[model samples]
Every structure is written in structure tokens, then in C-alpha cells.
Target chain A: MNHIFSFFVLGGIIAAAINGKIDVVTTAAMTAAGSAVQRAIALIGIVGLWMGIARVAEKSGLIDKLSHLIAPLFSWLFPSIPKNHPALGCILMNLSANILGFGNAATPFGLKAMQELQKLNNDPDTASEAMCTFLAINTSSVTLIPTTLIALRASAGSKNPSEIVGTVLFATTCSTITAIISDMIIRNLYRRRKYN
Target chain B: MTSEMLGESFSWFIPGLIFIVFLYGHIKGVRIFEVFIEGAQEGFIMAVKLIPYLIGIYISVGIFRESGAVDILVKLLSPILKVIKAPTDALLLSIIRSLSGPAALSMTMEIFDTHGPDSFIGRLASTMLGSSDTTFYIIAVYFGSVGIRKTRYSVLLGLLADFASFVASVYIVRKVFL
Candidate 1:
């Protein structure tokens, strides 16, 4: 994060100087925090709504049902994990929420799942194979609906805003499959070697 | 049914999910209302905690955009993108989407404005935007919260997924929409 942060700031400065876009740089820097705050504020309502629903989902035992539904698939994917582990439930909830396009709702569950997985980690500093796999899958999660994309397309005046849904689903599924496969390969490849 | 057809009824999906949960909780003898409030509170607090990180990343991303660094990167990567037959217009969106959501949205809007929404480039951009998460920002938030400094191969594999999504987006768009 630090390295990437510095690269953005320093690279931006150099590029702005070369491109003579100093005004844009100054303006953007000035409003950056304000814009970010606005975004966070906008997020509050959505987060609250989804988190509430997610909580209800948890209490309702839907999460358990979801875990059971995906248990076979989870077992195959996360062979290192035991069947009834808390991480398995959390992972199932997170992935289900993600598929529903409930990103805000998925995040807390994802964080909780990570914390649960961390409890099983032998090394505290390095991410475990399960963590890496989970992260990869979460990063490219398949969604049943691409709501934001549809909204964007609609606002842009597309006659068929949902036209790309099939493509998005297909593409995300491919990426998810690739993420899982590569994660497994990388995990095994680096298993014998110690990463410090 | 195709997802597009499902999209037409997407409005009910969330409410249906919530109703089902509420019903289940009631049947299971859980305090649905109280639990919902508790989760909502946590969500609010989480949003508050995210402010600093969000501001920091957004500022950096804004600076990156204003400075034209992304433009330079896109120009440099365009040859490779061309070799893969990705629309040149989507180069920035695919690159930035994994870094920052808002930045990628801006790029998507730019593409939509220039290419028109129904155009092949516009649809490709939209599909790519939908398919991937902001990997770096997610890693920073999730791992930083856990105090894990050594990320191992998470970043590499995450980028691999993003790469796969980008390639798949291009191919699928060509096959389905073109």
C-alpha cells in the first residue's frame, strides 16, 4: 500500500509537470478528501440496509443452509479446511452475498471469514493458501446480476442496458475458475519453499 | 433464463432475500429486529473506519488521473492490448478497475461517451467493469485490518484473475455481442 501510494503521488507530480496539467492536479488534490467523504456518506445507507439484511440472513439460518448447499464444492476447493469449520460458513455466506451483487453485505462476511481462516494459520504474517485462494475467489466473484453496470449502461442511454449480463456472467465465471486453478497451482508450487 | 432476462426482475431479488431471511429468523426464534439493528450498527461503524483508507486511496487515484500517468500506461500497454484484440478504448478501464472502482467508473463513462453505449467497445468496457473487483484496495483494507504484512502470492493471483477477466471479457463480448 505504501509503495503504491508513493508511486501514485510522485508519478502524478512528475506527469503533471510534464503534461502541464498542474491546475488539474491541484484541483483534484484539493477535492479528493471531500469526494471521498461524499462517497463514504453515500455508502452509509446502502451498507446499513444490506448489513441489516445480512444479519437477518445469518439469524434465519439461511447462511447454514447456504453452507450445506455449497459444502461439497467447498470441501473440494478448500481441502485443507475441515467440513464444519466457521470459515466454511463465512466463506459460503460471503460468496453467496457476492453472487447476489450485494457487495457491501459481502464485505463484513468476507472480513469475518478471513479472521476465522487466520485463526487456523500457523504463520501470522504470511497469508495461508486458503487465504490466498479465498482472496482470489472473492476478487473475481461471479455475480448473477451486474446491477452497477446495468445502471451505467442505462444512464448512458443504451436501449438494452442489461445486454452485457450474459457476457459479464460468462467472463466472471471464467476468471473465478482461473483464480481457483491458479491459486491451487501457486499454493503447491510454493509449498516446499518458505516465503518470508 | 439469460441473466439479462433475470435483470428485469432483479428489483425483487433483494427484497425477496430479506423477506426470506426475516421469515426464517422468526421461525428459528431469533430476534430478527435486534440482530438486524446490530448488524446495521456494525456496518455504519465499518463505513466510518473506512473513511481514512478511502480518502487516502481516492486522493492518490485522483492525482494519478490528473497527472496523466494512467494515459501513459495505457499508451504503453496498447500494443499488447492490440495483440490481444482488446478495444483500445477499454485499456484504461481494465487496468484501473482492479486498482480503484471510481476511477474505473470514470473510465467507463468516458468510453461510453466516446463510443456510445451500444457500441462494441462500450459493452466490453461495461462487462469488464462488472466482472472484477478492486483487488489492491480490497487487499489493503482486508489485510491491513488483520495486520498481515506478508501477502505472499495473493496479489499475483488476484492480478492473474483480473487478467483472466480482461481476456475473457474481450472474447465473450466479441462472441456474444459482435
Candidate 2:
């Protein structure tokens, strides 16, 4: 994180100097920060809206029912999670929120899932198979709605703001499928190399 | 399904989900209003907490784009990108998409502004942004929070997934939109 941040900042400044865009960079700094705050404010609206609904769904047992609807798939994906484990529930909720594209709502659930998975870690410093698989799938983002993109397109005055939803579904599905397969393959390879 | 049909259904999906949430809450006797307010407040807090992260990324990305460095990298990678049949315009987006959520949004917004949101590049950018999470950031935060150092092949898997997402977005956008 530290290196990437510094690298981007320093590299950009150096490149600006060579490209004689120091003035542009100076202007960008101000405008970028300004836009960042504006974007955050806008985020507050959507995040608040979805998280609110998610909370209601969670409290009303809707989310639980939804999780149960997909529990079989979760179990298959995370066979290592012990039956009735809290981490499994957390993982389910997290992935459900992710698939629904309620990303802000997903983060808390994901963090909770990580902590629960941590308790199951035999090697304190090493990531377990379940942890790796969870993180891999989480990072892959199996979103179905992608509310953010749709909202952005709407604001940008697209003729059909929601049109990307279909493409996003296809794209995210591909990534998630790839992530799961790769996780399975690499972990097996890791186990074989370590044990043999 | 046609894009228009898919879009209409999805557009209804959100409102349908919201209505079902409310109806279910009412049926379950949840303090629907209060719970919603509480969750909404949490959302405000989360958004506030994310501001610093967003500013940090936005500034760096803004400077990087302003400096023309991104364009240079795209140029240098054109041969390989061409060989792979990847859209050169989306190269920086896919790289930054994995690194920073806010940065990727900023890039997508710029693309939309430059190309018009209905254009092929704009639609492609939209799909790309929605296609994958910020893989590097997710790994760093999730594993870092757990204090796990030996992350093994998760990072590789995550990037591979990200690559798959980009390729899928490009292919689907071409097939459906172009």
C-alpha cells in the first residue's frame, strides 16, 4: 500500500515534469480532491439507501432466507467450513451482499467473515484454504446488479443507463468462475508440494 | 436476452428488492423504520470513513492521468495489447481497477465524459468497472486485517480473475453493443 501510493505520486510528478504538465498536475490536484469529496457525498446517498434496505432485509430474515436459498452453493464452495459455523454464515451474507452489488453493505460482513475465519486458522500467520478461497471469490466480485455503474451511467446521461447490467453480469460471472477454479487448483498444488 | 430486456428487468430488480424487503420486514414485525434509519446512519459513517481513502487515490490518479503517464504506458503496451486484442483505451482502467476502487471510478467517469456514456468505449468502461472488485485492495485489507502474511497464491488468483473480468467485459461489450 505504502509503496504503491508513493510510486504513483512520485512517478506522476516526475512524468509531469518531463512532459511539461506540471501546471496541469497542479490544477488536477485541486479538482481531484474536490471531486473526491463530491463523489463521497454522492456515495453517502446510495450507500445509505442500499445499506438501509439491506439492514431491513437482514432484520426481517429476508437476507437469511436469501442466504439459505444459496447455502448449498456456499457449502460446495467452502467445504472446509464446519457445519453451522459462524464464519460460514458471515461468508454467505458477505457474498450475498456482494452479488447483489450492495458493496458498502458487503464490507462489514466480509470483515466479520475474516475475523471468524481467523479463529479457525491453525497457522496464525498463514492464510488457510477457506480464507484464501473467500478472499479470492470476494475480490472477483460476482455482482448481478452493479448499482454503482448503473447510477454513474444514469448521471452521465446514457440512453439506457441500466444496459451495462447484462454485460456486467456476464463479466463478473466469468471472473468469479475463474477465481474459484484457480483457488481450487493453486491450493491443491500448494498442499501437494508441501506434503510430498 | 436482449440488452433492452435485460436492462428493464434489472431496473425493476432494485425496486422489487426494496419492496420485498419492506414487505418482509412488515410481516416479521421488525421495527422497519427505526432499523432503516440506523442502517442509513451507518452508511453515512461508512461513506465518511471512505473519504480519506478516496481522496488519497483520486489525487494520485488525477496527477498520474494529468501527467500523461497512463497514456505513455498504454502506448508502450500497445503491441502486446494489440496482440491480445485488448482495447488499448481500457488498459489503464484494468490496471487501476485492481489497485484502487476510487481511482477506477475516477477513470471510468473520465471515460464516460470523454466518449459519451452511450459510446462503445463508455459502455465497455462501465462493464469493466462493474465487472470486478479492486483485487489488490481487497487482498491487502482482508489479509492485513487478519494478520496473515503468507498469502500464497490468492493474489495470483485474484489478478487472474480480474484479467478474466476485463476480457469478458471487452468481449461482451463488442458482441452486444458493437
Candidate 3:
């Protein structure tokens, strides 16, 4: 993040000096900060509402129930995870949170899942296959309803804030499948090379 | 056609989700209202916490744009973007989506402000943002916590997913909206 920040800032300065747009850059930097706050303020209500409901879902065991629904597929994805193991449960919870787009809820469970997977690892320092798979899944998890996204769009005065929901679902499904398939193929290749 | 049908029903999706969540909570004997208030307070805090990151990203990206740097960069990548069917404006969001969440959000904001959120690029940005996660951040935190040194295939897998989602977002958006 630090590097990205400095790059954007210094890059902008250099480009402005070259283009003679220092005045425009100054004005943009000034208002951009103020506009960011305004956007965040506009975001509070909807994000709050969604988070509230997400909490209700979590407390009600709806998240657990949803995780249970995906348990069969979960087993198929991480067959190495022992059946009914704590790691499996943790992974389910994390993936459930991700699918709901409750990122704040997802992170803790994800970390816990990684810890459990580490417990099963042959080497503590090197990532195991399960850990790699879990990492892949989390990074490209399927999000069904991206609450923050819809909120941002609505705040931006979108004609239809939820209109992209279907597209997101399809796109994420494709991405997740791509991640899984590529991980499997690469894992196979690595194993072959190691044995050969 | 199927996507269009699904998109059409989205208006009721959130309302239904909320109703189900509350109803399930009630059935489970959970204190829905109290829990909701508690969570909403956390949400408010999250929003406040985001202010600094948002300010930093928006200012830099905004300056970058006004300075005409973004245009030059976009032009350099325009050929690749055209081949991928991604809008020139939404390209940064797609790349940044895998790297940083705040920066991607700021870029989306800039895109919406320049091209109305209902525009093709705007919708493209939203779909890309919604579908993808921050790959590098996920790898760092999850692997970092577990003290895993060799990420091996993780980086390749995560980036492949990110790239696929970007391309899929572009194709799916054009298919559904255009």
C-alpha cells in the first residue's frame, strides 16, 4: 500500500510537471479528500443496515445453516480435510461469510481455518496443499450479494444498484471454478515433477 | 436471457434476504433487534475507519487523473483492453481489485463520477468489483498468520482467478446490459 501510494503521488507530480497541469492536480487533490468523506457518509446507512442483518444471520445460525448446505461441495473441494474436522467447519463458516459478502466476518474465520490447516501441515513454514487451496478459494471466493458494492452504486445515484447482482454471481462462479481447476492442474504438475 | 431474468428479480433480492435473516433469527430465539443494533454500530465504525484509506486513495487517484497520467497509462494499455473488451476507464479498477480494496473503491468512485454509474464503464466497474476479492491481501494475511513462507501455487491460482473474473465481468456485462 505504501509503495502504491508513493507511486501514484510521485507519478502524478511528475506527469503534472511534464504536462503543465499542476493547477488541475492541486484542485483535484483538495476536493478529492472532501469527496471521499462525503461518499463514506453516504455509505453509512446502507452498510449499517446490511451489517446489522448479517449479524442477525450469524447469530441466528443462518450462516451455519448456509455452511451446512455447502458442506457436501466443501468436502469435494477439500477432500484432504478430515471429515467433521474443526478445519472443515471453520472453512465452511469462512466461505459462508464470503458468499454473503460479509468480509469483516469472513477474515477471522479464514484465519482460524488457516491455523487449523497449518496444524495438519507436514511443515509449519511451507504451505500445504490444503492451505494453498484454501488461500485460492478465499482470494477468489464467490460472492452472491455484494452489499458494499450495491451501497456504493446507490450512493453514486445508480439507476439500478442491484442490477449487476446477476452478473456478479455468474462472473464469480466462473472465477471460482477457474481458480479451483487451475489449482488442481498445477498441483498435479508439481506432484509429477517432484516424483520424476 | 437467463442473466436478464436474474437481473430483473434483483429488486426483491435484498428485501427478501433481510426478511429471511430476521425471520430465521426470530425462529432461532435470537434477539434480532438488539443484535442488529450491535452490528449496525460496528458497521458505522467500519465506515469511519474507512475514511482515512478512502481519503488517501481518492486524493492520489484524483490527482493522477487530473494530471493526465491516467490517460497516458490507459492509452498504453488500450490495445490490450480492447482485446479483452474491457472499458479503458474500468481497467484500473480490475487490476487494483486484486491488489487493494480501498484503492479499487476509490477508482470505482472516480469512474462513477466521470461516467454516470449507469454507464457501461460504471456497470463494468461495479461488476468487476463485486465479483473479485483482493488476492494479494488475502494471500498475505492468511499465509502470514500461518507463517507459511512458500506460497507456491497460491499466487498463480489467486491471480488466475482475478484475471478470469475481470474478463468474465466484461463479457457478462456486455452480454447482459448491452
Candidate 4:
């Protein structure tokens, strides 16, 4: 994190000098902090609302029910996990929150899921097949509605702010399928290499 | 239902699902309001923790874009992009959207201002933004949070997914919007 952060900041300034856009860089630096604050504020309401809903769902056993309903599918995806593992439940809720565009709420659930998976890990330093698979799924999880994108479009006065929702659904669905397939293939290859 | 109507219905589905959960919690004898407040508080804390990360990434991306680095790359990549049938202006967006979320968003806003929001490029940008995650940022934070150092195939698969989404976004936008 530290390395990438400094590299981007320093590299950006150096590149700006070479491109004669040093002035632009200076101005961007001045406003960038404000933009971050604005971005964070933008997330508060959406995050808060979804967090509440997720809590309701979890406390009501809705998440557990949903997980059980999807257990057969999850079992295929995560064959190593027992059919009734808590990790399976966490993973389901995390994916559900992500699909609903509740990214902030999804993180805690995802982290909890990772932590639970970690407990099942035989190796501490290296990522397991399950962890890698989870990461892939989380990164490209299919989102049904992209609220942030829609809000941005609407605020920009687009006539049809929600028009791209279909496109997002299609694209994310494709990517998610890609993620899972590739993950399974790669994990199998790694397992083969380990045995060899 | 038509695809557009299906999309709109899904948009409403989230709120409806939440309401159902609320009612279910009430019937199940769970203290909905109290649990909700606790969860909201956790969300706020999560938001707070992300501030520094968000600021750092946004500023770096802003500087990079403003410094014309993005322009140089876009120009260099124009031929390949044209072959892919993607707009030249969207090159930066496709790359950065997988790298940093705020940076990509700022770029999206820039595109919206430069080209009207209804333009093909604008819709394409929005779609790309909506479809993908910041691969690097997610791997960093999630892996870092769990103290996992040796991330063997996670980054590779994540980038592949990002690439798939970018290609899918462009293809969908062309087929649907253009």
C-alpha cells in the first residue's frame, strides 16, 4: 500500500512536468482532498441504509435461509467447505450485499468470511484455494443495480439515468462467470502442480 | 418483460427485499431497530477507515490524469482500442476503473462534461464504471486486512475478471446503446 501510494503520487508529478501539465497537477492536488471527502460523504447514506437492512436480514435468519436455499450451488463452488459451514453463510450474504450494490456493508461480511475461511487454512502465509476463489467471486460479483453510477448519471442531468443498468447487469454477469470458471481452472492446475 | 423494464424492476427489488427483511425480523421477534442502529454504526466506522485510502487513491489518480499521463497512454493505445471498437476517450476510464474507483469516477465526470451524458462514450463510461471493481484496491485491502501476504493467483484472476468486465461492457454498450 505504501509503495503504490508513493509511486503514483511521485510518478504522476514527474510525468506532469514532462508533459508540461505541472500546473494541472498542482491544481488537482489542491482539490483532490475535497473530492475524497465528497466521495466518502456520498457513501454514508447508502452504506447506512443497506447496513441496517442487512442486519435485519441477518437477525431474522433470512440470510441463513437464503444460504440454505443456495447451499447446493455453493457446495459445488466451495466443495471443501462442509455443507453447513458458517463460512458458506457469510459468503452468501457478502455476495448478496454486493449484488444489491451495498458495497460498504458487503466488506465487513466479506472480511468476516475471509477470517472464517482463514481458520480453516492449514497454511497461514499463503492464500488457500478457497480464499482465491472467494476473492475472485467478490471482485467480479454480479451487481443487479449500480446505484452509485445511476446517481452520478442523474446528477449529471442525463435524460435516462438508469439506462445503463441493463448493460451493467449483463457485463457483470459475464465477468462473474469468467471469474468463477477461471478460478476453478487455476486452482485445479495449482493442485496438480503441488502433487507433481 | 422488456429488458429495460426488467432492469427497472430489479432496481426496485432491492428496496422491496429490504422491506421484506424488516417485516421478517419483526415477526421473528428480533429487535430490528436496535440491530439496525448497531449495523449502521459499524458502517459509519467502516466509512471512516476508508477515508484515508480513498483520499490517497483519488489524489494520486487526479495528479496522474491532470499531468497528461493518461492522455499519452490513450494516444499510444488508440490503434488497439479502435480495433476493439472502443472509443479513444474511454481508454483511461477502462484502465483506471479497475485500478482506483475514485479516480475512475472523476474521469467519468470529466467525460460527462466533455461529451454530453447521453453520448455513446458517456453511457459506455457509466456502464464500465458500474460493471467492474477496483481490482488492485480490493486485493490490497481485503488481503491486507486478513494478513495474507503471499497472494499467489488472486491478483491474476482478479485482473482477468476486470478485463472480462471491460470487454463485456464495451460489447454490451455497442450492442445495446450504439
Candidate 5:
């Protein structure tokens, strides 16, 4: 079913390209791949560094202490996940990676979070509310530095490559806020419908 | 080395410091090799999963470019560009650039070489490419790899964000730098 939708979108794009829109599409694809490769390489290093740090932190008990410190805040944000759940730890690790703009690094943590979420779910077919909420937040993840953007800007020869930092911060914050609010609203509406 | 050269040498110092830190961590019982291999294995698996979507995205991009649809859309949106006080050339260039970075960069470089990098058009193209995302590629690759069947509002939001960045890049570059 979804394959059809994908086919249509692909067909539309191809049709456009054939009709002389190829220049734009071709350029976008090439650039995206180029940027993705460069970003991925940089991300591997960054993630490696962070993961090493995180591992050390865990070994030294800092992660536990830090998790304890941030437990209240995390609990407030994710009331769905029990405080002691392993998913909470995964979520924190994922969030930390995301905050640092290490999406490559965050990917494992995100998967781990999902795995943990799956364990807590009684129904294997339907996604849990926690899963939905996590997906919502992860999809609209807020990034402070936007390292990839900075790298792109620098490569594009921006004199002040980091100037967009403030704007990105504002935009991501708005997106995250919107995601959370919408998730809550939809969940509430669904609950109401089910009850009524 | 000269004093100035010595001062410039410190640029290498930070990376050296990082290497030492990594080594120290490795020696202190961190199984860096095993973890890295594990991560790489996962990444490879993800890359395999993403191939289909990536192909779809590439094909779509190919069709979009060939269909004359973008040109029509560009023409239709020209009036809106004027209202925003952005140069029509820059606006079009940005849209194209966002879709393809290297092509955009090459275009920017061409414009820069011909008109100079200090030109508004060159700066605008560079800025736009820098700030905005390759929306279709992101949707197809990232979301697809994760097996997100329904994108819901993500596609709309991503495109909207791209547009916002496109406009803002022009505004900032023109108003502040240019």
C-alpha cells in the first residue's frame, strides 16, 4: 500500500526531471550525498569520542549519578516511562547524543530506546503511547550546534559560518515544542474517543 | 621555526590532545575496537536498509528535474520572491542549490568566479545551500531506514523548515552581509 505512494512520488519526481527539471534534482541529490558522506565521517569521529566518554562515565558511575540528577526532569518530560525502566537510560543517552547534534551517534541509542520500549509493550502489534511520544520527540529532536549545517556553511565558504547558530536554535526549539504539544493533544483526543 | 609559525602550529595541538585522550581511555580498559566494530556493523545494516529508499529518492529527483515542473513552480513563485525583497535569481538559485549541494556550489563558484564571491547572488546561493536541507533525500533515507510507514506531518514540516531557512538565509545575507 505504502509502496504505491512511494512509486507515485518517485514517478512524479522522475517525470519532472525528464521535463528539464533534471538540473535541480540532479544537483540536490549530488549535494545531499556529498554532504551526507562528509557529515557521516565527522559524525563517526564525534560519536566515537562521545561514546568513549559515555562508556567511561558509565564505568565511573557518573552516568548513574547524572541520571539520578536528571531523573526528575526526564520524568517530567516522559511521564510514560517508569523512572527505573532501562528505556529511560536509553532515552537519556539518546537525548544527550541528539543535544550534541550527533545524529549518527544517537542512532544506536535511539534503536536501544526502541528495543527497551518493545520490552515494556504488552501488545506486539500496536505501538505504545510511549513509543509514539518517543518517536515524536526524536523526529523533532532539538539540536543546538547543528554541526552539519556549520560544516556545510564552511564548505560553501561562509565568512561567518557559525552565525546561523542562533536561528537554528530558535527553529529547532519551536519544532520540538510543537512536536510535544501536538503529541499530547493527539494522545488526549485518542483517549477521549476511546472512552466516549 | 619562526615565532609566527610556532604560534600557527598550535592548530595541530588540539587534535593531538584528542588522540592522547582516546589512547588514555583505551588503555584504561575501554574496548574501543569491539564497540567501534559493533557500531560499524549496525551502520552497514542501516545502509543496506536505506538503499531502496535512497534509490527511490534519487529517481524522484531525476523525474522532478526532467518534468519541467520545477521550472513552472519557480515561475509561479517569482512574484512571492519579489515581495520578500529577495532577488529572483538568488531565490531560484537557492531552491536549486538546496536540492543539490555540489551543483549549487559549482554554480555559486561559477557566479563567484564571474561576478566575484562578494556578489549578492553568489553569497545568497552559498548561504541558502548552507542553511537549508535536501528535504526529499532526508525523508527518503532517514525515515525510510527506520521503517516509518506513515510520515504524518514530518514531510510537511521538513519542507516548511527548508523554505523558512531558504528565505531567512537570503534575508540575513542580503541585510547583514551584502
Candidate 6:
């Protein structure tokens, strides 16, 4: 994978150089680098702020209360996850972050959830049902506020930038439903394969 | 005037809500400050881990855009986009949308500035921004952090979802709203 990625980069640079677009390539690369830095800064700032809030929530038992409040919903969505597991907490945090449109922020929690799930798997070769379900949910998680999108819109200079709120809600809801349905179908297939 | 309009629109309400949530969470004994510090510290580490991959992705996107590859691809696909009744500008916009929200916003702003916000292109860009994901970064960081070696299906599925949202946004906005 690293080799392939390196090849792509090298090939792209060589191609650009041959085509006499090296300057353009360089500029584009610089712009991209600058943009990445900006994105990192924005994400770090936002995620840090939220993490603090989430910490407070955790310390205050709000996260626990939230877990309980949303447990039923989570159970329905992720039946494969054992009740009262550490993965459950991580999954909840991941979901909450997604809901807030903080994909960057949701990432570590999602990774932690996966790590916890990995520890529970008895077989090293195959992923457990819970892990698969969690991945699907995380990938297709619904986003409500889309803070990043709003920020982008604001930066882009859109008038009434928040106008896409309704559309985002509808689209993400659809994606989430699609993801859930697909996950169920796949899981069922895997179960039949294992048992039959 | 625009800022005033935005303020009048109660735009601050969401940020306020975020603040309230944070406060509530803190009050619940989360030790928000400490946890936040810990998380930020983690983020710093994550950023360092990502340096190599970030360099790769940024360079690739840069090359694509700079070598006129993006433009060539966009031009080639423009007719197809038109046939599908999607906006040409949005195809490129969506690609950049997730990589950098601010850049995407500025691009959208430029479109809106050049062509009035009510224009088809402007509306399409707006809708695209709302609907898409930042695919590469999400895959790189989240999947990388988890040490998931194979992302064969997830990446494909994510991009597909992004495509669906992009196409659907145009269709819904044009057919139903506009």
C-alpha cells in the first residue's frame, strides 16, 4: 500500500514535470499543504473544545446519563454489541461526535471502540459481528449540525449559508438507513455462511 | 449588512447550543478541561502519525489540480453531468469540499459572487457542500488510527455515498425546490 501510494506521488510529479506544468503542480501542492495545515488547525481547535466539554460531561456523569438515555436507541442499532461493554461507551462517543458533524473528533473514539471490539473477538482471523456492525454504523452515521459544512459555507461566502440544513438532514438520514440495512444484509449472509 | 442578516437569523444559536452542551457535560463531573487537554495531547500525536500520509494526499490533490488534470477531468465529465442534470461546478466543488471546508466555502463564494447566489451553479454548490463527506481525510485518520490494514470496501462505499449525495442534491434541489 505504501509502495502504491509512493508510486502515485512519484508518477504524478514526473508526469507534471514532463508536461511543463511543474510550476502549476508546485503551486497546487503548496496550496494543498497550506489548506491541510488550516484544516488541522481548525479541527484541533474544534475537537479540543469539544473534548473538554465531553470530559466535563464524563466527569459529571453526564456521559453515563447520556449513555443510558441513548442505550435503547443504540441497542436497537447495534444489537451485536454486548450490553454494558466498554466498546459501547466508545461507540456512543463516536455516534455523538458524528451527530455534531465532528468527523475528526469522532475518529479517536471510533478507533478506541474498534480496539475494544478487537479485544473481545475470540478469533483473530475473522472480525466479530459486533465489529462489523460498529464499522457500518460509524461509516454511515447520521450528522445533524454539520458544523464543518457550515464553517465551509461561511468561509466560502455563501448568503444564508445555513439554508442547506434541511437537505443535509434528509441526505444523512438516508445514508444512515442505507448503511444499517446493508449491514444487516451482510451480517445475515455472514451468519449463514458460518452456520450452514 | 450580511453579518447583521446572519445574526438576525439566529445563527449563533447552534454555537450557543454547543457551548451549553459543553457546560452541561462539565457540570456532570467530566473534568472537561483535563479530558480536553488529554484529547488535544492525543490529537497532537495523531497529527504526527499522520505526517507521512498527509504529505502524500496533499501532494496528490495538488498535482491533480495543478497539472490541469482536475480541469481536464471536469471538462470531460461536464457533458455527462449536464445530461444527468447535475451542475458541472459541483463535481469539482464536492471533491474539494471535504478536503477543506473553508476552501470549499471560498470556492462556493466565488461561484456565488461571479454568478448570483440564486444561480443554478451557486445553489448546486451550496447543496453539494451540505451533502458530502471528506472522504480521504476520514479514511486516512480514522482507519489509520485503528490500524485497519484493509479498507477495500469502506473507501469504495464512502465515495459511493458521496457520489449519491452529490447527485441527489442536484436532483432534489432542482426538481423540487428550485
Q: Among these predicted structures, which one has the highest lDDT?
A: 1
Clashing pairs in 3: none
Q: What ranges in model 2 sit over 4 Å off?
A: A1-71, B1-76
C-alpha TM-score for every candidate: 0.86, 0.71, 0.66, 0.75, 0.60, 0.72
lDDT of 2 by residue, A61-114 (tens): 775665566667778888887665667766877887788777766776676577
| Tens-digit lDDT track of model 6 for B1-178 | 3434544444555466458767776565555566768756765555555555566667675666457554555777787687777766788887666454455777877887788565678667766766665665565655555455554345445555666667667776777467
Q: Tens digits of per-residue lDDT for model 4 on B1-178? A: 4445645766676568777988899999999889999877766766666677667667876787677776776787788787778877667787787666767898899999989778999999988888888876677556654567788899889978887888898899999986
Q: Looking at candidate 2, what is the lDDT of residue A143?
A: 87
Model 5's CAPRI class? incorrect
lDDT-wise, the better of 1 and 4 is 1
Write the number of the candidate with greater DockQ, choosing between 2 and 5.
2
The digit string of per-residue lDDT tens for model 5 on B1-178 reads 3323433554454455346545655666766566545545654565555555555555545444445555666888999887778876676665565354445556666665665444676556555644454555544544555565555444544445556656666666667664
True contacts kept of 5: 0.07
Q: Candidate 6: misplaced stretches above 4 Å?
A: A1-20, A26-49, A52-56, A59-61, A97-141, A145-163, A182-196, B1-40, B75-83, B98-100
Top TM-score model: 1
Please report, as a residue range, the 10-residue window in candidate 6 chain B with the lowest summed lDDT: B1-10
Residue-level lDDT of model 1, residues A74-182, one tens digit each, is 8898988777666888898778778878787687778667767889888888787788888999998678787777878999999988888889999999999999999
The lDDT values for all models are 0.81, 0.80, 0.78, 0.79, 0.57, 0.63
Lowest lDDT 10-mer window, candidate 4 chain B?
A: B1-10
Q: What is the per-residue lDDT of model 4 for residues A34-95, given as tens digits with 9 covering 90 to 100?
A: 88778777766756666666667777888778777888998899888777666787898788
Ranking by TM-score: 1, 4, 6, 2, 3, 5
For model 3, what is the error of residue A99's alpha carbon versus the real structure, in angstroms, after optimal superposition? 1.0
Question: Where in model 5 is the C-alpha error above 4 Å?
Answer: A1-196, B1-36, B89-118, B121-127, B170-178
Off by over 4 Å in 4: A1-17, A20-63, B1-69
Ten contiguous residues with the weakest lDDT in model 3 chain B:
B1-10
Q: Which ten residues in a row have the lowest lDDT in candidate 1 chain B?
A: B2-11
Clashes of each: 0, 0, 0, 0, 26, 15
Per-candidate iRMS values, in order, are 2.9, 5.3, 7.3, 4.4, 6.5, 4.6
Listed in order, the DockQ scores are 0.64, 0.53, 0.47, 0.55, 0.17, 0.36
